[model samples]
Target: MVNANKVETEDEYIHVRFRDPDQFDEIRTPEWAEDPAHSVSEGSEVRMGQEEGSDDWQVESVLIKKNVGEDKAKDQAEEIVEKIES
Candidate 1:
């Protein structure tokens, strides 16, 4: 609920911490929002929030075309990470 944006990543994801992580315990990750299969992705859903403790959230998963090249994929992933850190 804080911010939203597009990002690419194979495994790296952005996590948001909350003042009360325990309150979000009842929440659950959607079927489509499950973790990635360790594949490349771009413009994938940049999710935020955790299901339980720390009220944290993370990049649900990234999606990229199968034929996409490595450089572009890597750049996209890096951009997502940079946005998270910055």
Candidate 2:
């Protein structure tokens, strides 16, 4: 099961945890949002990083997009976590 997290900052984002952080490459970029076709707003982005004081890894997707909705961001993040953990 994937647990969603509340973003602690002004940036609108969706967060999730992974059991194994080392199995994949961590990506942080806004390029996905740059094309205006990725369904994300101009400033939207995604990244993977270590969660402080925890064995689980975290992936955050900045979701305030002009396209469909923020649901895409959470869905994408959840997909990644599930893929990597499997």
Tell me each candidate's RMSD, in Å, in order: 9.3, 7.4
Which residue pairs of candidate 1 clash? Answer: 21-54, 21-55, 41-63, 41-64, 42-63, 49-57, 50-56
Off by over 4 Å in 1: 1-43, 47-51
lDDT by residue (1-86, candidate 2, tens digit) is 55555432233443333334454445444343334413333344445545555555445443433343446655554554454445
Model 2, position 63: C-alpha lDDT score: 41
Q: Indicate the TM-score of model 2.
A: 0.35
Off by over 4 Å in 2: 7-46, 51-66
TM-score for candidate 1, residues paired by index: 0.35
Can you give the lDDT of residue 78 in candidate 1?
Answer: 46
Residue 27 local lDDT, model 2: 41
Tens digit per residue, CA lDDT, model 1, 1-86: 22223333344443322223343444443445323322324333333446644655554333444345444544544454445535
What pairs collide in candidate 2? Answer: 41-65
Overall local distance difference test of candidate 1: 0.40
